[model samples]
Target: MNEANNHVFDTTTGEEQHLSKRNGSSNGTSKNGVANKIPSISEIKAAIPNHCFKSTIKQSMYYVFKDIILIIALYCFGHWVLQCNSIILKTALSPVYWFLQGTLLFAVFVLGHDCNHGSFSSYALLNDCLGTVLHSFVMTPYYPWKISHRHHHNNTGNMDKDEIFYPIRKKDNNKNSFALFFGLGFGWLAYLWRGFGPRQMNHWIPRHAIFAKHVVGCILSIGVVGIWVGILGYYVQLMGMVSLVYHYMIPVFICGCYIVMVTFLHHSDINLPWYSDDNWDSVKGKLSSVDRDYGIFHDVIHTIGTHQVHHLFPIIPHYNLREATTHFRKAFPQLVHINDKSIFPAFTEMFFKYSSQCIVENDAKIHYYK
Candidate 1:
């Protein structure tokens, strides 16, 4: 660890306090080996160039238009493949089409993520409008999911409050293995239908406790999703079930897999810490995230894998995250946690170890996956 740069925020006074100043220990290591001090949000933000925080409508829309054009082109090519007489060729090519289509759709969801953060553009109405359309197309309820997601951001790594990818308490039964397995394909949907962790309210139900503060936004998102479903049904009727399955259902399932996997990976590492409210704060929660390298798909999904910086400063647009992350690492090298493991092998290891790693002591003020 970089002892000279180690610092923790004084939340009450909103000032930076060096860890060495608080105690005789020259380094900020706790008995458990985790760093005791974390950089404040302000300190991290000041490290990045101010231009990275600016979001322009034209620049954001360019990526949107680019994705839309590619999706259309892929759709056209897939349609042409449907007319091919060779069954072997279709069998060989189907998976390729599904992978590409689903990946791009997940990228679209990343764009919606920016909208929810108000990083896609300066206008609130514009952000809401784009978020609703993007999420609905990806089979998600926009504002309801957005509201819950905001809760997740605000309460990340908080044992009693985090909305998703929350650690399993040791006192709870080990039955979560099945739920974790199912999560890869349908977790996002399940979370929206019913809540996750300590929040038990349904996102689709505007009157649900989770949506109590944002009922109007929730209802509007639900209505938009309903309309999207109607359009999907009409498309199925016009194009037949096989076409719908080939082009829509399979790809949507693929996108869902990506969404769940990326989210789970960002928060569920075996070494990451979870805190009780007594020790939890926004700075600590944001630093709890891990930055993973997705290789070629990194930029394909809009640099979302550069997650630590995004969590620390979501106002930084996706396009500017890489530069912001560069500065963040230089500013506080010890604080930035990057997981360089290859995706497939890493996820496989985490999968088998999840039930064990996710369970933390029920009474501990700070918990780590054991």
Candidate 2:
């Protein structure tokens, strides 16, 4: 058989496929006896255009401008709602107004995330400056989050130690089945309070030192909240707080769920392989991560869906991720495609979808049964 046709196939499905090799390689022949090459992360990054690797000052400015516009628009909506006191009108308008507010907040989070990667600006300092302001406005500590997030990127699909969303192993899968449901509901609170809240000011990164220079920023935020309360009186503050909770906090929680669920489904799928200590390397660990096609939301929130490319060249700005992703897709057709349609369905399936997955192989074969 020709080299390309040497990988195995399932005749019943009538498509080319490769079974995971017992030795953690795709070097085996298919049922049709075709061979396939699974390109490494370096190989994929090398194949992409040079421009895709570079972030620009102009792009950063564009994101900052967009964020400003979103914030202003949200403020206008909130003001309009506050002016109207009719119960029916307020009830009906509240959800719509909050949806817009939540979406704007999500955009703010995306911009901050871009800055954290140093992809929002050509100047690293500028990115840090803007990121700190944007994150603090949203109640996230910029430097603290940036440091932990960097670790997450460095170890994307390592079964034993990915910094965030490390999947549960069979032995460690002691939680009752019902726990996953409650956990999903309260996941953001748990993530922020347990994982990030206490550690905010304690991390080694300078930005995380909130009690130092950033104490002023925290006090400023409190002052703004207090001033708004004083102007509108206690009842207005109460209503405003309710509005913020429903609009900002609740939707932030939903977005967090969306992020976690997507990340979990990406790496936790039945077909993807994870690595153990012996076989783990940065490139292999990242390639073990999957990319999803998030459809139109890709443009609205930025192209975070092209995650493999993000992992490969994190310096590449979100604007150029799609270009890099296209390059890799051409070179590696067998690469797993986890588009948006798969995400919600996977969430519905829940434990059946991702309960006991591992990154590496057992006795040379990719272990799926956990």
Candidate 3:
């Protein structure tokens, strides 16, 4: 393979049609006597137009401001509507407000996500500043999440090392139900409280396994989140507990649900493959993601469902994902898999279908969820 912009490309072989038939003697090469040509991550990056990588402060800030404006406007509107004193009207509208507000908050999280990738701004400090503020507003610890999320991106489909959404072992019964119930309800919070996988880390603890490398950053993240919680506590004192629950807690809960649902669907699919560390390469691991279409909410929540390319090139701004994805599909048609199923039905289907079988045998080189 030819070298490109960021790094030199290695002429790597891709996954075989029958990966099980191939011995594990060679890395990135199929020993099954079949030719399987797949592009390297660098090769794919080169395929995307250079413009897609451009993330201007104005454009990025525009999205950040837009989401904030919508969220504020909705909160104000909900506040006014809550005054009507009609129990029926309030009951009908509260859920709608929660859904819209939650979705907009998740959109903010996506922008923070871009910031974490250093795609929100060319300046690293600015990215950190904005990322910390935006993520903390959504009650996530920015640096701690940034650290673990980097690991997640680096090892998306590697069963051994993936940080979040690691496949559950079959023998670990009822984990699926727990994942479905708790993961759907307060999964993100639980993850922050105690991480997933064998390590079972806590994102807030500076001395945790993945966290020890950047203890200072982790502490700063915790401090920021603590400040946010303090502000929320003061808000409760001023606005009363009922108002706090109605206005903030419920909406945040909805956003958490959105986070879990989108993340679970993005990685866990019946057709997606998981690889042993020995068999995993950047290209194969990245391709394991499923690009989804969320209809009207696509732009509302920032095309986070355009996940395949995002996994491949996390530096690409969220705004440019559609264009980058178009180029990506054209360049490597066979590699692209977009799930066009509607959001709720798709989540339901995959949630149940793969819930019990996401686990793989310890010795399996390549595994797919049943």
Candidate 4:
């Protein structure tokens, strides 16, 4: 296992990433090495530059301002679209706003996610403030989700310790698997409220002390949301329930579904494994997930699609995610998982295996998606 100098090259171009030798197959896993024997997460982190770990307040503010302005501009444009003189034109064009606006909302949600990771800015308070507001706008209970997310990263690949996104045990089959697949998009809402998805994470471990400080922030966010709802209610009265549902709720639903699906795919893709304690450690925990490219929308949404690097070094800001991902893939070329075939097709493949092949047998040493 002394693979410190192994060099992995890109299979397609055969280009050298100027990094380590690859450990396994074309897919990234090590055939000779057991699941637990990959390089350590600390080793991976050390390979990344020190500056990747640092953040600047000014740069963070620039992104914050940029996302906010974009969301506002999108909203105003939606309003203008709604006021189109011809009813037919207005009705036809409104969903466009919902899709674009809801996507922007999720864009800022990524910003908040960066804040939650303490990677958005050097100032902890500022990150907290922005994260709380941005997540709240998307109906996420900020502090609660933040603390839970911390648990998730801390124990990403340990099936028992991992807070959310853990797979079902093989013997634990139930009638709900199909239902769960159909409803996967609502996973985020379920995670936040019902404790349904990701195994009702908060119910198992309530971080009371951590949540207390942010209770006021959560409440204030609710108040702000109440105001937004009031505005929506006003529109509902003017536009009717069907119109509101079509233009507002559906778009938001689309965005929420997309977020959760992407999150699910990050960890549950083909060949990734969830380990028992004997086989579990930091490096495998990171390698357990994959990164995706979202094509055109990639940059606008932050480099969140470059998720493997983010999971390993959550402190790396979104602006630096692409660079960090490149460095990591080159360094650990054997360990990095990329979906070059396209996002949706790959998601379809992984998610299908996720439902069918990922069940953990009770007596197995290690479990992976089939």
Maximum-lDDT candidate? 1
- Which residues of candidate 4, in runs, are more than 4 Å off? 1-29, 32-37, 85-92, 170-174, 180-185, 201-247
Clashes of 3: 0
Q: Which lDDT tens digits does candidate 3 get at residues 1-370?
A: 1111111111112222222233223333233221147787788888899999989999999999899889989999899777779999988998899899999988998899999998898999999988999999988899989998898998988888887776655444344355564466488888877776454777777566777778887788779889999999999889889888888888888888988888888887655677889988878888878777888899999899999889988888999999998888656654655566677887787667665566667677877654
TM-score of 1: 0.89
Model 1 lDDT per residue over 156-253, tens place: 88887898767666675455454755476577677767666545657777566667787888888889989998998999889988988888888888
What TM-score goes with each of the models?
0.89, 0.72, 0.87, 0.81
Shift in Å, residue 337, candidate 4: 1.2
**Quick one: ranking by TM-score, best first?**
1, 3, 4, 2
What RMSD does each model have against the real structure?
A: 6.0, 7.0, 7.1, 4.8
TM-score of 2: 0.72
> Which tens-of-lDDT digit does each residue in 1-370 have in candidate 4?
2344244332222222223443433334354222323677778887788888888988877887887898778767776776669898778878777877777777878888899999988788888877877876676666677776787898888876676557656565453654444365476666666554335444223434545665665566556566667878899899898767755676667678768777876776545668876667876786667677788878878877888888888999988887787778657666755554477676676667666765666655666664
Highest TM-score against the true fold, candidate: 1
Residue pairs clashing in model 3 are none
Q: Which parts of model 3 have CA positions greater than 4 angstroms off?
A: 1-35, 169-182
